[model samples]
Target: MFDLDRWIEIFQTLSKNKLRTVLSGFTIAFAILLFTLLFGIGNGLKHTFEEQFKGDAQNSIYIRSGRTTKPYKGLQSGRRIQFRNEDSKFMNDKFSEKIQFFSPNIERFNVQAIYKGEQNSYTVRGVYPDYQALEEAVMEQGRFLSVLDIKNKAKVVAIGRLVEKDLYGQLSALGKNITLGGISYKVIGVFSDPGGDNDERFIYTPFTTAQGIYKPNDEVDRYGLTFNPSLSVDQALSFSNLLTKLLKEKHNVDPRDQRAIRVQNYAEGTKNVEQFMGVLNIIILFIGIGTLVAGIIGISNIMVYIVKERTKELGIRKALGATPKSIIGMIMMESIFVTALAGYAGLLLGVFTLNALGDSLEKYFILNPSVETYVVVGATIILIIAGTVAGYIPAKRAARIKPIVALNDE
Candidate 1:
């Protein structure tokens, strides 16, 4: 199996046509490199898109009030639609089983926040305890708002990381007091949001406290609702539609007026994004496979030319009692050696490029572009099979050469 003479002959044949061999190897290498990079880029794009949805629950919906644009039941066309605390309670009573988490918000924009002598204006909102999970807020230093805080109407506040930096300036913000609009509240938590600095500039307080001190009239600005996780995307959207219709009827808003109530279903958005990414992946796969097929065809054509040029040598070996199997094996071995080396080089270069650029690309949301181990193994197996197939036809032709005819050719 380890024939030194056979190895010497193979090396000698390859060395005779160095330029042609290098060109053949380059074609295979380029194909593999292109495929690996395309696949890596596709994965990076998918990762980036997923990051954009990390700020909220996958099955969440946001409902906000707007002015009615159409007349209904003899009401005027320009009636301002508003949600109240009573509506939130009614929805909880009606859909307790279908709902997972619900939060009613009342917001005051450009509220001045003061800690010690430093003061800055930020958006302040009143929300229930469940708003923490609904907004995907991670506690960096202290605990989030508790249900007890909401029920007791405690004057406690949860500030974001950016707010903590601005007000407290590297000091422990937990258990400290911060004044909002001349009203002092104890800091109970500091949170970080995945949506970056914009989401991290707000302050959260108990809805009851805000309603009591600010609105005092039971007015709600918006509602955040998340359905049971077991529900499908379409089912969740249907439930949201039903809830919207009921709210419109109850508030005397026109059912056909889309402007009266704005509902944003994150699940529906995620589905559309996934569908687009699926099409993108298919396109990349097609291009990669097409390039690889072209390279394999080139290898096959080169093998045919090599065989034709070596006809005289093959015939002389046949006359010296060489068997058809030996001739075929020689040709196949050369093809496999060349393709395997080229494919390996391509794999290494592709992985190295991704690793070198991973850090720089993270700002653009393209992170950790890589191919899996199984994929690399699969590509190698495919290369070996392709090599065998590429040489098969030429190997057969070499085996069929007549010793006398081949030797007589000029």
Candidate 2:
């Protein structure tokens, strides 16, 4: 199967025709390179979209209250709506099955947290044990807030990893006392969040402890909960809508009031994200298909031109008693070889470029741009096949032509 003389002849021809070789190689290489880069950038965009939405649980919903914007049931438009422990109980009693991991929050910003001589301003939240899941916090050093801690109003806190680092330096914050607003709480845990730095800088304390210390009575600032994961996006939206409507009615707000009670549903935003991602996928697929088609066409035309330019040479071979099969085989082999080399070169170059880029494109939201190895290899094979087919047609035509006519052409 290994024909040494044929290979030598092929190499000799390629080396002698430098322009032809470079033209063919460049066509295949550029096509493959373009396709790889475009696909990598598209995937980078997809990664950016995913990262943007990873700040909270995918099924999360937040309920917050503001002053009523419209009068209803004799209530004035300027009435300030509020969430309370009674509202939390009402939600649990009414929508127990629809809700998952509910938490009533009492949040305070610019809280001065002091540990020994170190002090910093941070956001502190009083939350239920289930708040860990709501915030998607993972316990790194110890345990999160327990139900017993909430019931007993324990002076214990779960500090974020960044909070611990900022105050405790390299020393562990676990079991240490941190004073917030002159009230000292023992650090029972340290947590990390995928939600990034801002989330990481928060301090979580037992709901009852913070509530008793900060609130006038049983007041809650806001509520956060995740819906049942089994629910479809439409079902989740419906659940949130019903919950919003009921909350509005319970508060005596107008049905059309926009600011009295508001629900922020992650699922609603995810629906738009899904739609955009679908359109994006279609666009990427279209671009890839279009690029492959253009590459095939370009290589096919170039192969045909190469054959035309060598018509006299082919005629000379025919006169020397070379068979039609040998003629087609030689041309096809050269075209395939060139295409294979160029394609591989493109693949390596594309991968190297992506690696060299690293996270430098993060500002542009193009993180870790790359293409799968199999994908690039398959694309290269396709080009090689296209080159063979392109060379076959013209080679067959050249072989059929009378040797005298080909040699006589000016």
Candidate 3:
């Protein structure tokens, strides 16, 4: 497939009118560069979203109590709804077969933690064992709370990396005693998270331990639940609705009081995220194509000017028995060489720049870089088509020029 002679001819022709060819090539190259950057950013966003979803069950549903906006079952509007441990137990026992994992969250604020007289203020959580999976925490030392810890209201605690650094400094925190809210708990685990500041500012203990130590009178804040993996989206929605109605009835509240209890469905979140990304991709694609169109127009104009300058040469060739096909092929070769070389250069430059920026760029904007294969392929095809079209009109006009008329013209 390599045609060294033909390529030499293309280079020779390009060298004759260096400025014009360079300008055309620059247009195509700039277009490719702009397109590559847009697509790279789009892909990055997709990657970041995927990573974020990994931290929690994408199909999980969360239930939280809120104030009623409308009167329900003799209760007045503005009444605050509360969910207790009994509600969580009821959901687990009633829907055991439908559920995969479930937990109740009890969180308190501004807990003072002290280790060897050094102190810091952080949020403390009383969480079930499943909180490890729910929050996607990775323990760096010892272990998370076990079932026995919860049952016995053990004094063992798991602290975040931020807490460990503040309390222990460079010293190992495992097996050490730290006083939280004036009650001492043995440090059983130190953990890390992707949740940034929020994760760093929280400590975890067994739910029972936390409740007994902190807010023994307050109800649990929310219920976190994930259904069996085999469940369909529609089925999950229906099942969640049924569970919501049962909970409303049990609490002596009206079923239709949306504000009294809120159910957050990951399936719905997923649908919304998909639709949003779809619209975003369409806009990005249009911008890329629009730039390419401008580049194509530039290429077309340059080819027309080059053809005009070569009118006499083309006429001499025609009189010497050169066919119209040969003339068209020569013009096309020049166009293809210029566009392909510039476009490829632009693509490489864009890719290199993005790769260098990597996670740093992503972290700043809370997005990820994730360019896909199909986009690169699509851009290449567009380059070729634009090149061919740009050359065609000028090539046809040159082929029609009469030898006598072309020679007579200045």
Q: What is the C-alpha lDDT of each candidate?
A: 0.87, 0.92, 0.82
For model 2, how does the per-residue alpha-carbon lDDT over 1-410 read when each residue is reduced to its tens digit? Answer: 99999999999999999999999899899888888887788788888888887868999999999999887887789899988899999999999998989999999999999998999999999999999998889999999999999999999999999999999999999999999999989999999999999999999999899999999689999999999998999999999999999999898889899888989999998999899889987898788878878989999999999999999999899999999999999999999999999998988888888888869989998877888788888888898999999999999999898899889866
> Can you give the TM-score per candidate against the true fold?
0.89, 0.92, 0.80
Candidate 3: residue 48 Cα off by (Å): 8.1
Q: In angstroms, how far off is 246's CA in candidate 3?
A: 2.2
User: Model 2, which residues run further than 4 Å from truth?
Assistant: 352-368, 402-410
Ranking by TM-score: 2, 1, 3
Backbone clashes, candidate 1: 0
Put the candidates in lDDT order, highest first: 2, 1, 3
Q: Report the error of model 1 at residue 93, Å.
A: 2.5
For model 3, how does the per-residue alpha-carbon lDDT over 308-375 read when each residue is reduced to its tens digit? 88888888888998888988888888877777888888888878878887878865553656466577
Position 174, candidate 3: lDDT: 96
**Model 1: how far residue 47 lies from native, Å:** 3.8
For model 1, how big is the CA root-mean-square deviation?
A: 2.9
Alpha-carbon shift of residue 299 in model 2 (angstroms)? 0.3
Q: Which ten residues in a row have the lowest lDDT in candidate 1?
A: 372-381
Query: Alpha carbon lDDT of residue 209, candidate 2?
Result: 91
Q: Please report how far candidate 1 places residue 397 from its true position, in Å.
A: 3.8
Lowest summed-lDDT stretch of 10 residues in model 2? 367-376
For every candidate in turn, the CA RMSD to the true structure comes to: 2.9, 2.3, 4.1
TM-score of the candidate numbered 2? 0.92
lDDT of 1 by residue, 86-187 (tens): 899889998898899899998999999999999999999999989987888999988888889999999999999999999889798899999999999999
Badly placed stretches (over 4 Å) of model 1 are 1-9, 319-323, 351-377, 400-410
